[model samples]
Target: MLVRIRGAWFVAVGVVVAVVATALLLVTRAGADTDRCTRFRDAADDRAGLVTGVGADLLVIGDSYSVGLGVGAAESWPTRLPGRVRVGGFSGSGFSRGASPCGDVSYAARAARDLPESEIVVVEGGLNDFDQPAAAVEDGFERLLARLDDRRVLVVGPAPAPERAAAVPAVDALLADLAREHGVGYLSMAEADLPYLDDGLHLTVEGHRQFGDLVAGALSTARQPGR
Candidate 1:
């Protein structure tokens, strides 16, 4: 009986150790991912002349869609945008949550940071906040708008993806409502039929071009007299 008890205790200890190890591994991986994101951001800044602290005509703060994660820099939508544009995009980031798959960056956090000066600031990407509570997402949007109170701000709602189609409209509606309440211009892509990659989430190069043109046109329209 004593031997059996000892064996059970040993098995229990092993399970505990395994759980601890798995947790450590996850933490380590998360830290590594965060570090990688920081490096990528720094490199992007260098490439975009942001390292010089020079401002651009437009500043876009968003997630992987803005970064053109799977495509070349030139193929990214921001590059297709007219005039000088600076992009602040991180993967797996959203307004309501941080410490995501890519890093601890969130839209609210990005807005709170000292951003480069720009004539127009566009806050994009809220799809990641789909699973989060409505109250949390609203709070995040409020915080972000509060930070950019002095800037000409536009809120771009996330486009629909085949994989997440059901959740897109809710987020889009919430963003549109918030934009209206905050007196900011809001663009809704909930009904946009854009090409997507195999994952049915990220946009293709062609999709980027389409999106860029749409936004460029919107900007032009907004700039017109009596707009």
Candidate 2:
């Protein structure tokens, strides 16, 4: 009887230890994410301010595509864009979902905090929110648009990628619908035949140039007087 009781006690202790360890790991991860987000946010904020100081005509808030993750910043599409454009992009950010492996820096949050004033604010990105609920993504986008009420806003949907081909269409459609509902300009890259790297996600350097050209044309048309 005593031996059985001892074994039971051991099992209970093991379970408790496992539970405590798991909890500690989760807390540690959360803390690390918080730290990373703080550092990233500070740096991004400073950069945005500098861009604004240059009298930026356009401000773009997006994810790695905006940052040009694989390619260098100078080669990024945002840089290739016309005029003095400021890009506030964080890797792994989405409209609803926060930056993965980082802290809570979503599109709505960035629009509300990180970005500065500009003549045109382009809200780009939805790829990261692929698996997220549609309602959540919509809610986040609504919040972002609310904050940008005073600015000329443009909603740019995620580009078509072989990897996320299925989800990309849904996201594009949703963003397009939302932009129309909000009476803002919307750009859908769903059928874009852009080149991608091996990852089949981000655009290649050439692809970025093509994308930049496309956007420049759109902006030019929008700039024309009257409807």
Candidate 3:
């Protein structure tokens, strides 16, 4: 289907595809009844237990997963970041669906129009594009990164979700290549020790904390002296 979002015409990405991705995205959320990540959950006040670093104002552009669907604002990972964090992205967004059906602006376009001053910017998505054609995914990624060329940015590849176990390598490689092509930092969460909810795709609160810590560490390391 052709979708016009934020003045751009998008074609080929499927609503059903995005829907399936959303389903997978939720699979790893809470209430799955098989999650052990929560077995190690700390008290509410223990939110700082994961890891903390010198916070920096951060802009995170991602999908529902990044926005913390099914979770409270304070409990969302972005909110947990040790800095001023602004979270924005459509729930089922992806590179392929840049001009989203829901009228959400594409990340690249959003950055082009208005990217707030921040220490770092995170451009995340793609898990929702898992089933999409690589060509389209790359096209979208490239367009977005092109607009972000002037910013200190990090490109986070998709995580290793059980549902995408087999295709992880190719997708991860594509994302890594894209990041390298633009000379931006890239983080591979495919093999990271993040705890997935139940559907084995979405991340639990603890998982978000861990991921946030990872991002924070990377940001810290990036600002370190010449290495």
* Candidate number of the best lDDT: 2
Name model 2 segments beyond 4 Å from true.
31-56, 97-104, 221-227
Give per-residue lDDT, candidate 2, residue 117. Answer: 65
The lDDT values for all models are 0.75, 0.76, 0.64
Return the top candidate by TM-score.
Answer: 1
Which parts of model 3 are misplaced by more than 4 Å? 1-56, 98-105, 220-227
lDDT tens readout by residue for model 3, 1-227: 24456234333356667888898877755344233223212221132222223456677777656656555445566665667667654455666653344433456665666666677777676677777688888888777767665567777777777877777777788888877766778888778777777878778888888877777667643321111
lDDT of 1 by residue, 1-227 (tens): 99999999999999999999999999999889778778667645543553212335788888777777666556777776666788877766788864255544778787677577777777778888878888878888888777777777777788898888899999999988987777788888898889999998989999988887777666632221112
Candidate 1 worst ten-residue window by lDDT: 218-227
lDDT score at residue 127, model 3, on the 0-100 scale: 77
Q: Which candidate, 1 or 3, would have the higher TM-score against the true structure? A: 1
Kindly list the per-residue Cα lDDT of model 2 for residues 1-227, writing each as its tens digit. 99999999999999999999999999998898788777656655544543422444888888877777676566667776666788888877888854255655788786777556677877778888888888989888888877787777767788988899999988899988878777788888889899999999988999888887777666632221111
